[model samples]
Target: MRKKKVLLVLLLISQFIVLAQDYKFGKVSKEELKEKFYPLDSTADAAYLYKSRRTYYDYVQNMGFQLVTEIHERVKIYTKEGFDMATKAIVYYTPESGEDERVNSIKGYTFNLVGNKIQKEKLSQKSVFREQLNRFRTSKKITMPKIKEGSVIEIKYKLISPYIQSINDFHFQHHIPVKKLEAQVEIPEYFVFNKKTIGYYNVKLIKESKGGRIGDTQYGVNVFKFDEDNIPALKNDEPFVSNISNYRAGMKFELTQMNFISIGGDFKTFSSSWSNVSKQIYKSSSFGGELSKSGYYKDDLEKILTENTTETDKLLAVFQFIKGKVKWNEYYGIYSDKGVRKAYKDRVGNVADINLMLTSMLRSAGLNANPVLVSTRNNGVPVFPTIDGFNYVISMVELTNRGYVLLDATEPYSTPNILPKRTLNWNGRKITKEGNSSWVKLTSSKPAAEDNNLMVTISKDLLVTGLFRTKYFNLSGLTYRKNHNHLTEESVINSLEEKNNLEIEEFKLINENLIGKPVIRNVKFSSDNLVESINGKIYLEPMLFLTQHTNPFKLAGRKFPVDFTTPWKVKNMVSIKIPKGYKVEKLPESIAVGLPENLGVFKFKVKESGGKINTICVLQFNNAIIAPQYYNALKDFYGQIVKKQSEKIVLVKQ
Candidate 1:
């Protein structure tokens, strides 16, 4: 008991010392510049020495409350890689119609040690620039002056906005280590907000209720504060993550309800449930409104669905008709641009304009169809009940006695139940005509498959010439079409030749334009790099250019789930014809490995028959997502795969 008390006292003293350190915007200490590496994470190239943010609502005489946010942060660079840390980009929403956020009072300084003295450089206005991220978002980028290794930089800025409901999400952690962190949020009594937290790291914020005055008006206030030290950086670039920001340590505020206490005690509630949010979005003119208007494409749709006899046939015809009629404009939004009518007339539109039209046509054909609101892979998953949850929309049809099928008209090559990879994030909200909605899985039900067949012949000159044929199915097919459809055959051949360091005799791509069929690619190539001759023996990898030389899973530990996008399989069949005088002396042993709970399996087999070497390698993963608990096992699984594929087939002259 006595030892515990001593330790508690020492911890308190240490915290007090950290709080006593000077953190003023311009008062950078030499101790920060003298630091060569972060103690918490030595691998970190840079670290946040201190960061502070305070957000509150400010009231005016008659203009109502405005959101005010203050930001101040100091960074220490330990290496040349950290020099990029000096440039900061702050993004803000800039809708076309509403009041937009404005940044002001931007100031920064870089402090470095020179001749045992502190030298400071002020940020230049010329280095500050602004650019539009999208139609509704803008970024203000600032580059600190005199940034180099062993330098400390500090920045202070204030953001003001009239949209109180648009409270910016606050992140307590970053890609670099943080030595000190402080954050506070103050809300008035008239407003109520619900907070959602994400990521594995958690920080407790103290909450308190108090009273404050706003120009002769006494109002209740709620304040949340967090102060901490030594926060390790989060590794963001984990393999197969849909969006790392979704797994970042941060907090988001959603306005649940609001009341004007002084004005007759009137109140209003935002989306309190997913059902309520869905109903609100469904009734909007932009989404459901567009679905109801189909006069523009009525004739074209009818002509296409006229010859179809079955419901499935009609559905497929309508989907294909929409894709051919309307092309995507490279934009993503749940709301229609103008309307489905205008989009059809123009022959181009955003995601909503295309998919909503398909839904309308399906419904008109007496089929049960609805629009599924999706937050694409890049937008992250929508975990809360808010109107801003989804950024894309797709069509879903349910037959009388069969399971539903998802369709995306925005993708020209998409087929029923096989959506483009961009829409395969997690789940989407499907809203019906009855104003009801339900969550539907957005990931593909079918697996992405790749089948490769190689026939190889070795020359006495140590050159490898072969015929390679590969086929892609389901998601694999869609990926191939999306990646190479825009490139010419010559460009495609050149790209393949350059990547593999080989000379191509002939290249053929088949079924690329067939929507639902597998895409087949066959190439005839010769390469001397595929085999290595040590002394009088020949050695080559089993898969040749197809071998995975490096493991994609490299993290020592991972908190995020491993997302494969979809269940997948790869099958390889290779037949190697040995040289006339060569005899097989060695072959990699056959092995089979399976992941826990049948998540994945790999089978590698090789045999010699009639002077020809035959190898069959099959790898299949059953699940699109594996929990973080299985990360180590997944890493080990991939490690074994890499090791096996890299094993050489040795042959020598008899």
Candidate 2:
């Protein structure tokens, strides 16, 4: 009887231990949880972990977990001259315990020269642990099984070379579904989150614990769900937790705050180091090989100067060559096998590769040219001298007589004096011959382009006819040129004609040269009975230009600084020869408006000479960037120009 009684007690203890390890579902009583827990929200039927409490536990307890990662890499040898390569990476995670620990075990395996082709491979694994006395204190580990149904893993690599090179020819093949598949994308404020890539499909749930002294029952996953397609499968080799729906439901998330979990994947390659890769298969490989090359000065001198060349001729020649030879690809990368030689041969490359080629060619021609690295406006302003801050480059060449001329070969319509839009980054760094770099002011100088022309005639139908021509130079010219190539003349004419409800009878482009001068556009069109007729009188608008003077800012207040780098001077001439049976009754009142320090100016004048009414209008902006404090003044300046330009001339029929 005594032995049986002891056996029964041992059995009861074992049963209690087993029950503690098993998952349990129970509701907390009001009395038991009175102070310890509270309702999640007024609409929630049950209590949950509060955000403040969850954050506290995440920092104190969950962040204390330990993680161990191992990586094994093997590279194969191919040739005597190898490829240039390097790897950069970053790791981020949320800690599950108070003390978070990470151990990285990485090893590199090299290859011998026995094989003509090289192969490379990498193996990686990660193990996570929590500090607990018993298994019940931690969540259970759930491992996925092999698929018994139709399933597949597809991997894709988005490889971008420095120049035009074939990644497929490199023979770089690895296991499907490379790890960390999601790209660190830049999401502007106006855009929306769209889709997910194939790499996000491997995510697995890891843990699920109820909200407690450490916080609400937190759920952990092996991979992050990005878009709708990131839903995980149950039959994968990796382990996962299944309570993702619940975790997502509890947290309010936005596209900006979204992040991913760290999961290890296997990769294999034959090449051990990038320096040892072969370049025979590549079309052009520079920096990785030995070659004699001149800097930007030599190239510029050879192309811009000759025995009989003048300062203006040399400048114009250099500008024309840069604009005509190279094409813009718009990509940004530092490592490309298709260096300057290949880019020049192909006549096309990304911003860096092409601009660098221009710099090199300019040097080869014996011109004083230097590479100016700049951050594109869309790429954001650079806050420091970090190498990764610049995404674009332009060439600045010093003239024998004149100052420096900023040249961009990528823009076909840009003059030698005009810089591309991308060069407007806060400031640029000028890379010099001594391997030293310094900040270069990108501000524009005075004496930019200011043009005005007018023609007046009397039609046989006894109606007034006028022609106006306006041309821009410097930064103003650059802006127009940038948008010119995006659409054809017919497209622009059709859009404008429809907008104005007018028929275009004659349209011609007088000039398309974009090397050293502003573009000159001549549009000839007519409208039937444009003037309003009232009591034997006719009135016509003085301004016929489509892009008339208008205010760009109308908001009451602004928090951000206003930036306008280009200055402009516009001239409009309207000549109205009196019709055979009509005479001018009243001319628009002459007006003149000016702002401080030549920031902006406008003028309107009409003169009657030999029965002809000659009207002239001019507007100019002499400053690029305007401060917020001056927004109201600038707005008023433009308003006055628009009002003066819109004035009408009255005529009486005989």
**Best model per lDDT:** 1
In candidate 1, which residue pairs get closer than 3 Å at backbone N, Cα or C atoms, i.e. clash?
none
Model 2, global lDDT: 0.45
lDDT of 2 by residue, 1-654 (tens): 999999987885454333222111121122212222111112211111110101111123533322222222111111112111112131222134332222232222121212333222221122122233221123211111121111111111122111111111100112111111111122222212222211212333122323222245343322222211112111222112111121121112121122222122222222222111212111123321212254424544554566426555654566567556767765654323255666666877666556656655555555677767676666555332233345566777777777777767777766665676556656776666544556677766643564756565546553434454657666666666667657888897897567654456566555444434666666555555556777777677665443265556566643234555456566767666766688788877999888776677888888788877877777767776555577667678878767776677787877
Compute the lDDT for candidate 1.
Answer: 0.88
Q: Name the candidate that leads on TM-score.
A: 1
TM-score of each: 0.89, 0.53
For model 2, the stretches where C-alpha displacement exceeds 4 angstroms are: 1-319, 333-337, 446-472, 475-482, 485-489, 499-502, 545-550
lDDT, candidate 1, 12-82, per-residue tens: 64763464278877997766778787765779999888989999998877887899999999999999999
Reference-based lDDT, residue 407, model 2 = 69
How many clashes in each candidate?
0, 64
